[model samples]
Target: MRRADEKDDDHVTELVSRAEQALDELIKDIEALVRLESPSSDLDALRRSADLVTEIGTRYLGVGPERIEIDGRPHLAWRLGDGPRRVIVLAHHDTVWPVGSWGDDPWSLVDGVIRGPGCFDMITGILQAMLGIRLLVEDGVDVDGLTLLVTADEEIGSPTSRALIESEAQGCTAAFVLEASGPGGALKTERKGTSNYFVNVVGRAAHAGLEPEKGVNAGVELAHQVLAINTLGDPDLGTTVTPTVLSAGTTTNTVPAKARISVDVRVRTIDEQQRVDEDFGRLHAVLPGAVLEVEGGPNRPPLQASASQDLFARAQELAAAAGLDALESIAVGGASDGNFTAGVGIPTLDGLGAVGGGAHADDEHVIVDRIPGRTALLAILIKDQLSA
Candidate 1:
């Protein structure tokens, strides 16, 4: 075992050189994953994607992941090394792009850029992790107490994998999320917690052309609720309460008797999340004869900076040791499975994924040149943790 402080520069350079040598194979693995279109909504696609991931993981790590299925969706888990301390490498295989959205040719490599569905959003991160582990094993570094969990549903908010993530994160020393990097590849130290709500209104129906006054309008009640909900946002504290989707009415001749409002809530702190939850629970219908029903609260808790500060500091040290550019950390509004781990009181660091731009957009891509250095950095981070 190599100590982190002993011959640190040589160790960093050697790992980086090994990663560079494996760059071609890394790109090949990434292409294999990108070729498979695994949209979050498609179970069949997810299954195929899981199979491909299992194969690639086995080929690289010399071991297959255990397939943990939830609600017919397959999630992959690998428990490597059997040490006293445990850490998790959290990633997801699902992409936002639907099937056929990327057209016939989903894979492309041009001008040292690889473009495809799920390439930047996190496919490369998965591959990079595998390569990092492979490098660690080849160099005789102990990877015991490491768990790599590649979940199947993330693009749609990890409906099936949240509990599993929380369970796996318990008592772990650190969680490294393989989500896409922020602008300029900054590590994500903080992420706002998210909540989803559906406000339903029920009212009596009546003829719009005749006695519209007799009708208790659900649409009117929904409008009132939307206005009320909009007031809950605190811009100074970075809390946003947005009513995104709305629906009401039965026919053109009748007053709207049923309505629904989909609310999206984001908060930077648990206090704010609790405040919003209480505010939402107090919502009431202004119109007479309208009953309101609110469902769904706090999906993922905030990934607080406290959960990542130590890991971020250590990562900076590793980067410096590797002779790489200084690492930067950012707080993003987006949430990931990292939120679940962090919420469970685990130290979590995020955005240690592919360096690229335009995630979830048509031009989603990965910078081909950054792969080796990033992979090497990840390996070094993991080795440091294992050594400790």
Candidate 2:
């Protein structure tokens, strides 16, 4: 009974001690994961990433290769030990940057920073979970049940992967999403749901030099749609519509007959989604040529504050006990696979990834020195949560 009164860090130190010895293997694992070019929409890249993940899962976590397919990609799940409480450690094998989108060679650790596609948003989080699970197993700490889920469609709003995430999360006790934390490494608490919509316009075409009245410019029609979307911006409500990509011309002389604009939407609540729908619908009335077709919805379920404060309070307590300077946090708008498990009624923690910048840009890099600390933090969290 006296043991139950002890502190979480008492168990944390032992797990960290063992994990410290696995640093080299951890780096190797991260490098290998980053090397696989698994853009969520690319079939070949998804296959390669799946094979690597399955190999590791089978070799270390005691999970087999065969996975039930949901959206034509393998949603690999592995676990160790069984207890009444089941928690999912969520991450994505898919990357936002596709093959050839980065530097000449996108794989390798340069001065401790692993450079490659999918390193931050978020293959590194996946590695952290793998190593954390390994450390827990080595320490003989029996967590109720830990399910590590790596999916292939998180980068593209998870349309093909959402059903599988929900199914896997059905009876789990809690989840920890591995999305990158805040700019300064603070963890995430609440996140707004996101959507990607498309608007297409069609107009008559004629020779600009010969017949001016005979032609209608599709680009001009698309411009009207863009302006309509701009009017929906509510910065106060965290609702926004950004028309990020547009294509409208085949040649300089021709009046464009077709144009398409891709819009990215973010909403903090379900009610905001309705507002976005209403706002977007107005585009057709303003521009009759616009044959807008919206696709994708609610990428990440708004990561509502945990129903029970025990989960967040417990996490804050553990971090404090572990000697982290302070329990830092802020609500973010980004989504992660963890959102799925938590949305399905599991207590989910997030922002457990390597400290880094340039996640989806050319300058993407990880803080080399922070690897050990982040790895140590994860090891501690697992042990603290599972220790009886």
Candidate 3:
């Protein structure tokens, strides 16, 4: 067993070199993908993107992906190998930026950088995952089982696709999310969970000029609740309660009958999640004759450190073996499909995508030279996990 393990490691090390050699083809793959603008709300655009992915998967894996449509948006899934042990590669094709936002041309390769609406945020990672699997298959590496899931609605908080993602994650040994890396190529071992709330205040409306004294002001009540909600943030615990969107009043003059406020809650732990949930639930309308109702909580649970440490350690080892810089793990406030998998007790490693900045920004782009190394790192980790 030891001898076979050593042989597999050597093979994987060589496979890393092979991955580097395949850089040109991989870059073209990424360019092709980034050119397709698949916004979360655009079903036609997302389907077109899915078609491209299906073509690529069929060309390399000899089997196309299974398309799953949720609320008219399409998601793709490809299962490779039939071994009992399974690993999932979680990715999304939807980008936050809309089309034509990248100026005249969204797809431009300039001096070792690819800039576009979705280039760095995740198109690169999606391609890298395909390339990694291609390399593994072409090399005849022993892969137990691998599932590649590309969803279409992640950018807008994954409202429709969380069930599908969690279902696929049920028995997987590990999961890897291909979200773009942070500055300087940092991976993510922990991510804060997002608990969103829609706080609605209902109060009696009366004419401002005619019967102002009879009106119960919902807007004023919402103001007080907003202040209380803002106070829920604790910098020490990395918990924040921010009211992002507020809507009130049918007209400016009347004391608004209904006021709605959206609260964004982020927490670093499940304990914090519960605390915030309970606290938010306990909130009551301060003003007499007004009622407060809170809806929605914890869209994605935190990818706790304990659930990711082992996978992150393995990633670091593989990075070192591939002659790359030591991989660092971080805790980010933004959540991913990784949060779902980790929340379900799967060891999940995240941010294994291209090394770049400007996710969801017009300047969004990926470091061109880093693609091969990142792809190789993922290939090595997948190969190593299969060996184990």
Alpha-carbon lDDT, every model? 0.91, 0.71, 0.86
Which one wins on TM-score?
1
The most accurate candidate by lDDT is 1
lDDT for 196 (candidate 3): 91
Tens digits of per-residue lDDT for model 1 on 60-178? 89999999999989999998966654889999999989888888889999999999999999999999999999999998888888999999998888999999999988878889898
How many steric overlaps does candidate 2 have? 3
| lDDT measured at residue 352 in model 2 versus the true structure, 0 to 100 | 73
lDDT of candidate 3 over 41-93, digit per residue (tens) = 77888889889888876876778888998888888988777766488999999
Between 2 and 3, whose lDDT is larger?
A: 3
Ranking by lDDT: 1, 3, 2
TM-scores for the candidates: 0.97, 0.87, 0.95
**Could you tell me the lDDT of residue 274 within candidate 3?**
94
Task: For candidate 1, give the lDDT of residue 233.
Answer: 94
lDDT of 2 by residue, 71-186 (tens): 57777877556654466677888887867786567786777777778787787777777877776676667765666778888877777878877876677656677777677776
